[model samples]
Target: MDRAEFLNRLEAQLLDVPQAEREEALQYYEDYLNDAGDAGDFDILQELGTPEEVADSIRNGLRQDSSAAGERSGQADEN
Candidate 1:
């Protein structure tokens, strides 16, 4: 798929995520694609995998970050 289609699919998959996070992810990918001027859409897709895969990665990363932040906050509270 092309960049637009890939981003659309990713946005659809990210519907359950918060708006700010979703937008940030989309913008990050958009910038990534723009920076890859030498690569074609297929190449980028191949490197990144499908939108579902990318969205899952983003979600997983967010979950890990959130968990870490919560743990830090809890430790601070206990101190």
Candidate 2:
């Protein structure tokens, strides 16, 4: 997918995430793409997996963090 489409899909996937975090992630990726473009890497879009794959990876990380926090809280309650 092209730059616009990639970013669009990413934003949509991030709907469930907080607005601040979502914007931060989007900015980071935008910077990444800009840097790659500066380096003449026009194929960066192809290199970065499809937007959906990237979003899934991000969502998985969020889920893992939430799970870990929940486990920690549960343990604390039991103590």
Best of the candidates, lDDT: 1
Best-fitting candidate, scored by TM-score = 1
lDDT of each: 0.93, 0.83
lDDT of 2 by residue, 25-55 (tens): 8898898898777554457877778878888
Error of 2 at 60 (Å): 0.8
TM-score of 1: 0.93
* TM-score, one value per model: 0.93, 0.75
